[model samples]
Target: MSLAIVDAREWQNLLDLRTGKKVKDDDPRVQAPQTATLRDVLRRHPYPGDSDPRSNRWVTDSALDLVAAYEPQLACVVYGHQYFAGRYTPMTDVQRKGMMEELFAEIDRFVARSGYEPVVVGTGDMVPLEGEIDLGKLEGLAISSHWSARYAGLHRATPRDLDHVRSLAKVERVVGRDEWLAAFPDAEAVPARVPEHLLLAEEGWTFVTTGTPMRRPVRVPGRGFRIPLSTRLGAAPSLLDIRGLVLSGAAAGKKVALIVAEGVGMNDFLLPFTPCANQTGWHYYEPGDGFYLTLSTGRHQVFAYPSGYNYLDETDEKKDLPFSGYFLDFPAHALGDDFPGKSVAAGNHSMFVHMVFGADVCMECFARNLYNQGGFGVIHRFR
Candidate 1:
């Protein structure tokens, strides 16, 4: 069976990331008068159009091309719509719609010639004009969330709200309604919900803990002891900390769901780990030194970062930083004893990483930019 990973991000955000050069006026490169097409601009600044290549737009088109060359059935679904109801930018709804249409058309043509289809999922209201382009005809699922707009407007929508939206869109059959409802419980609600039709189940990973657990310990290689997952109040360091759940499973040929709070940023130690394989959205990091410890035994890799919070507004001050000394206190150790000739890097700070074993044994990770009420990642194996 083929593996699929679906990620949701604002249409403009996706374009900016893929192109590496923001189309905004603030970008000096964007201001340079030229008749070059968007494609040309992207080709020139293949990485984020900045001094730092690992900035927000680190996932270049070439990376996707590489993945496609290996996984023929892979589909990267890009959802177009505002995660929250607000004037996020100076652009009006009409302007936003026009921009989306143009970008979508360019992508459609590119995919037609490339054979690797990146589905463009959008709402009915966001759909292009009748004669412009029929995005629905493409390998994508277009759903109308009009019924759930009321809840979305208040930023209080739940997974159930999204389920209702999918039902209204008439794509429930494509999404397999019964299976979705059965997979995740509607116990806690989140700010935004990506339609189930767009996402495929992540197999193997299982939830071990929900809502931070107290001083429970887990063994770390070479530590010769166990350490708590967390030790802050309520076993969490910040209010943004959603019900922390430990998902344990093999990462063999599977995709893992990631829905992190929008404002959180990774520190310097985490920067190198951004733009993970098959990942989308802004791979941001907080500015400072932090550490992460990792160990790999052939096909199996294990790593952990201290749970911390980084608010967008207060990027300067370090508040509620998860104490990383607990894990980094040990001297740098090589993995030779456990796995001869293997080397493990020592890091300081919170960051997410995905290790690709080989062509057929790659791992997928995704993070969506949305409000942080609560979130969970489930990995389901193919039947």
Candidate 2:
């Protein structure tokens, strides 16, 4: 992946922390000179978002576009993060319901062109959890109320084969996984391991989600509410027919969610998908940082900054962006300050929403953008 975007990266000069000495690029201790730590090239790039390329649209999209451009080179299996990649035909905008038919058909075309057979797996998001593990308690960490499982490093065992999703999707494999991978090809490859698909199941019922699935209005253009799917909040859930899943789950008294296993590697993913390309001998490029950015949230602030780390922890060392200064007296006119009359923002993200928007009432879930605990929301309303 580093080699794929070599031209765009800004290779970092090395330094020995303890001795305060400069480390040469060829130093034996430098296992990965372009690692996330050393790769100043990757750290500054943003995530996928809108055309504007800020945090939501601008910041996130730049990061995502980086991935779409480079990750495919890392592995043909990635074949581009969106199904649209490797498409033999151009996509025509259609209603949401027609999307699958259009997608599957194009996927079939790519298969035919590539000399590969289509796995056409019919899958659902619903699966039962036989047991659970809490990283918060085990690791002695504080769980984010919005999405505790993420910080807690919660773990669960999903069936190696999702017979349930296949039974529903009908042909063979599960449809989608809630959490998607980062694909910023140009941005510094910010290292984000992975987060679980937000799910809550009890008494034979389960609800799994991948976007801001809490109390909020997503759309109604005529009424003056329009959330662009380009922003992290809008972009993610917009990718899938989450409404159908929620409705189906509600009707059946059972919910559907993508299932996964931890410590699983790419070899397992290769079972149904194309293998990532081997570009070592295939390509010859040198020296640039691999950026890491989370391209999944925000409306505009992302573009306002070069990377997404600003939204995570205020106390965390602020990179390219300015200090959050949470306790400092915020000017009445910070970026997202709205009506003097109480304003509210609710979604699945945790610290980010409160930090960026400064809303009077900030409600969240998907605890800290990591956990998926359900049946509630974390509401922060000013008295």
Candidate 1 — which residues are off by over 4 angstroms? 1-64, 67-71, 79-87, 117-120, 123-383
Ten-residue region with minimum lDDT total, candidate 2: 284-293
The total number of steric clashes, by the backbone 3 Å criterion, in model 1 comes to: 14
**Best prediction by lDDT:** 2
Q: What TM-score, to 2 decimals, does candidate 1 have?
A: 0.24
| Per-residue lDDT over 272-315 for candidate 2, one digit per residue giving the tens place of the 0 to 100 score | 33221111121100000000001111121111222111223434
Best by TM-score: 1
The 10-residue segment of model 1 with minimum total lDDT is 342-351
Score every model by TM-score. Answer: 0.24, 0.22
